[model samples]
Target: MLVTPVDNSEIVAALDAALDGGPAVLPLSADDPRAGELRVAMAPDEPTLPGTAVVVATSGSTGAPKGVELSAAALTASATATHARLGGQGQWLLTLPAHHIAGVQVIVRSLLAGTPPVLRGGQTFATAVASMTGPRRYTSLVPTQLLRLLDDPVGLEALCSLDAVLLGGAATPAPLLDGARAAGVRVSTTYGMSETAGGCVYDGKPLDGVRARLADGVIELSGPVLASGYRRDPGGTAAAFVDGWFRTTDLGLLAADGTLSVLGRADFMINTGGVKVAPAAVEAVLVAQPGVAEVCVVDLPDEEWGQLVAAAVVPVDPARPPSVAALRAAVRARLGGPATPKLVRFTDALPLQGPGKVNRKGVKDMLRGT
Candidate 1:
């Protein structure tokens, strides 16, 4: 069957119907060019996912669009497990776009809990909260949105009143996480992706049935919540999933107690002078500096060292920004010389690709161009 794309309110309704055992739906941004690409990928074909409920597109920031096929059972399992982990099912607020897995899952979870999601629309968090009927309510957001909310007293207070705030879509900076918790926000930093139906791991621990393991430092996931496979790409699906386990590109460490600490993506490691450096680890150290508000660390081509670590920084105060020399000293003290950035360029903001994820590839080009 041909796939019809939907967005905004229609997506919520479509997802509700799908959760109630309707035909599969592939969501796409109303204005995004990838909608055509995704529709083509989901075109009528042999061996299609029988009970597939949603086909979500990957970030598409790197230029190609690929759909992750999610079966109804997988999507519902994720919703059930999330509700169990979060203490109970509650009304949800859809702040993210339905074209993304995060947004689609929000609709599924709300419907499964017998409540319609309250879309953020053009209203404040406080106003959104006022519209909610359930005493137990929750909202999902990315780290950047959480950072912005921290500056709004009313919004911060509104978030504080919620049962829990699920923060995901990207890594949360140490300062951001600490600040939110310090401000009385019940924030759970999530880990997982479109492949795992949004977040399978919450706050470094796997949810009810999701299993996280390490294959030579890379994270591998398995359980009922995993996606069926990629749509129209048998090769990609086979490469990512094998024997009921999905091989993740992210590198992680599973503590003896079963807590997983993600060590950034294996492809994200920057090689400088025969040494490998994890950008997340380096950013964690730099972000703690006084004036740095946000930072993105990437590798730049260097004739001398082959590849040099470079950073694009967004300062708390542009006029009184931390000097590159000072930033280097801070990293050198904590992460050693190889991990220290060779070049530091301060900027007003970091470019973003997907929901709250820092566009590292864009940052690298910006730093390298100058």
Candidate 2:
């Protein structure tokens, strides 16, 4: 949820009203007009769905909204484990949009801590931290959100005060992580989705009630925290989960220390000539370049290679667009042969869906008929 106020008082009033309904109310962004347009009429004798305290809709960057049913038991288990991991819950500075599971987790964790998270003004992350009512502060942010916060000195300073900062939603840039660590922020990169009740894996470690495994390079999650299953979408539910393990589209590796390192989504794999390549692996290297801020690698049809590996890049330095040859050389230097992108394209910004995830399909279309 993206909270926007036509009047400031209304926002406060809504929060107050929500709190009045329940001391543990999770206040979320109700600003999207489309959210208001959704209507659910109750029947006089309709029975409630079993085990559903809340049903959060998935971000649907890939497809349609998946109503993930979460029981109070599941949410409580997640929040309790999270609190224990962070040395008990403190005042949370809500940053991510409320509609997201990540944002929802903040409220749930705060409620479990017996204190509602404080809402900061929509201006900056630092301001949000400053607005919090007590000590032992925490916040969750996506990589893009974290990058925006880095732009402000005050925000960076405020971030350093947090006990732990959970970062998730997509793969984070290495440079950004380095910047956060350099600033003395307790950053924890997490990996999980709506099905696992937000981030069950924090900083590569699976939390209590969360289990992770890698079978043939694909990440499989099995735990009490996993959603009862994707709501009503049988085909999707069947395709994603098997034998109690949620077969994530994302690929991962289990280190000897038992930490999970998510590689990239298997769906994003591309075939160049006869070799299979993960575009995200290439994008990861591209983003590490001196001038590159963001990047997306996709496979396009080619007369010679069957599929030409191309990179859509957003350079941090506008004056210096990394040339095709330079990018190819960089790829060669970092990851050789099949992993290197052949074509490099400079873009103002990679097409993002809602948050900062690269829209691969959109990028593919953008490169089409060129």
Query: What value does the lDDT take at residue 277 in candidate 2?
Result: 86
TM-score of each: 0.97, 0.86
TM-score for candidate 2? 0.86
Q: lDDT of each structure?
A: 0.88, 0.72
* Model 2 lDDT, residue 223, Cα: 80
Question: Which residue pairs does candidate 2 place in steric collision?
Answer: 1-98, 1-99
Write one digit per residue (lDDT tens) for candidate 1, span 1-370. 4246565788888777777777677777877766676676667453457778888889976557677889889998999999998899999998888789899888899888999999988898889988998747998999889999999999999999999899999888999999999999999989999999999999999998999999999999999999989888889999999999999999999999999999898998988999999999999999999988999999999999989999899999999999889999999999999999999999998999878888877898789774
In angstroms, the error of model 2 at 100 is: 1.2
Candidate 1 lDDT score relative to the true structure: 0.88
- Identify the candidate with maximal lDDT: 1
TM-score of 1: 0.97
Write down the worst ten-residue block by lDDT for model 1. 39-48
Tell me the lDDT of model 1 at 18. 76
- Cα lDDT for residue 207, model 1? 92
Candidate 1 ranges with C-alpha deviation above 4 Å? 44-47
